[model samples]
Target: MHEQNPALGLVHVLRAVTVEFDLLGAEFAARHGLHPTDVRALIHLLDATRAGTRATPGWLGEQLRLHSAGTTALIDRLERLGLVRRSRDTADRRRVLLEVEEKATELGWAFFGPVIGEVLAAAEGFEAAELETVRRFLTSVLESVGRARSA
Candidate 1:
């Protein structure tokens, strides 16, 4: 309880959430015949697209902490699966960019749409101010994790 150690309780909850996500990710990987690293790469590409950021293989390599050969191999695997494609940047024809294919998005939504819906349904229980507080808390937690990763 908060009376004893609030931080420990929050950490436990976060850990539980992480475990659940990892399990779900594993299931998705198995069903799709993808390695965990492949799933992570897809997620990074999707996030970058959503953020309106151009995602290059080099950037993805950094995000995945992979060497060029590993990154190329991963990309090749995804491309062979038709889940990803390489495109030349129009602004700089020499630069290659990674793009998630529609099939990948459709597959991802097919698997995770219900989970997303449930999350939104649960969020509906909170008032605006309460949701704001939750957002702030989550943002701080993300920042802490980012700092720890860099350190």
Candidate 2:
């Protein structure tokens, strides 16, 4: 199929990539003895840490589309695994914050480093303009998926 053929080429590429990611996620979860949802919650917490932000059970529940009870249970499981810790916010004693443990953070980086390196290396083959276009395309795809989910 021609690269310019959105229906045949782009759509197939998108679908394939999505499936590949899903499979990869499942594998990662299995390796860590976690459920897929737990892996996702960990990823969200990791992302928040990288962004210099803290995640709360309430916020994580909303993000994961899980109820409060479910979120609390997930958090409890993670804590038992030594992957995460819950603490009271110093600024707000009533607020509880979830933080990824250092060992768990290291484990994630070690497991995902090769894949991340390969992705970066692949992007290095593209010119700045091409990379920018790819970024924009991915952003649009993400927005579209979010809209579809909400609908």
Candidate 3:
């Protein structure tokens, strides 16, 4: 009998997690009358705001692997739904920033709050060191995947 490669096992686990996450995202999108891609773009915009950074349509395009026209259409759709708005950057007048609407934030938290609380509660079971290890591992995985995609 041959032993399975640990790396291969980890890859399988990660793949399963990715699939589950995608399914969850799809469900969330459907509940909000959005496509999965739009939900993901909105999440990215929200995260950027949380990090004190503004997200531009071009940046969102790159993040979502969308072209300029597609990104514009997405922004238009979200803007029409009142989930996001486009504002000119104060410092860079030529730059248009995507801002998630307050109502959208409220809706997101209302919909995802329970799961967020559960995930936070689960994290409390881990020690600080274990959490740090997990964070580092996930970051490394993200880097590796980014490199692979670019390559």
Candidate 4:
């Protein structure tokens, strides 16, 4: 099928990604004691550090594509484990920020090193231009789909 045949091409690519990504998530979760749901939450928190922005539960819920209740529960478990905390935003009493603790932050960073190393090794031959193109494309795709309710 050609790329112009969007439905068939997209379906094939999407299925392949879904299978591989699911396995990656399962393996990471197994090795980390983080369920698939919690792994996504951790990923959300980990990625949010790029902008030095603290996400509220609402923000994280949106980021993780979780409903309010689910986000609340996820945070609840995380907070209980001392991984994440709900802190009132000093600038606004009404704003509650979800903060990943220092220990969780350190541990989470270490946890993802292997995944990054593997991907880097796999991309070793890609030209800088090609790498940038892939980065932009993936970033755009992620931004478009990050809050999606379903795959």
Q: Give the best candidate by TM-score.
A: 1
Model 2 spans > 4 angstroms off:
1-4
What does the lDDT come to for candidate 1? Answer: 0.96
Ranking by lDDT: 1, 3, 2, 4
Candidate 3 vs candidate 4: the TM-score winner is 3
Counted clashes in each candidate structure: 0, 0, 0, 0
- lDDT-wise, the better of 1 and 2 is 1
lDDT of 2 by residue, 1-151 (tens): 4357655677789899889878988988899899999989989998898898779999999889999899999999999999999999999999999999987888778878888899999999999999999899889988999999889
Candidate 3 lowest-lDDT run of ten: 107-116
TM-score of each candidate? 0.96, 0.91, 0.91, 0.73
| Residue-wise C-alpha lDDT for candidate 3, range 27-138, written one tens digit per residue | 8889989999898998899889889977999999999999999999999999999999999999999989889998889988888898889989999999999999989998
- Give the residue spans of candidate 4 off by over 4 A: 1-18, 143-151
Query: What is each predicted model's overall lDDT from 0 to 1?
Result: 0.96, 0.90, 0.91, 0.80
Q: Across residues 39-116, which tens digit of lDDT does each residue of candidate 1 receive?
A: 999999999999998999999999999999999999999999999999999999999999999999999999999999
lDDT for model 2 comes to 0.90
Pick the winner on lDDT between candidates 1 and 3: 1
Say what the RMSD of model 1 is: 1.5
> Residue 92 in model 4: shift from native, Å?
0.9
Query: Mind sharing the TM-score for model 4?
Result: 0.73
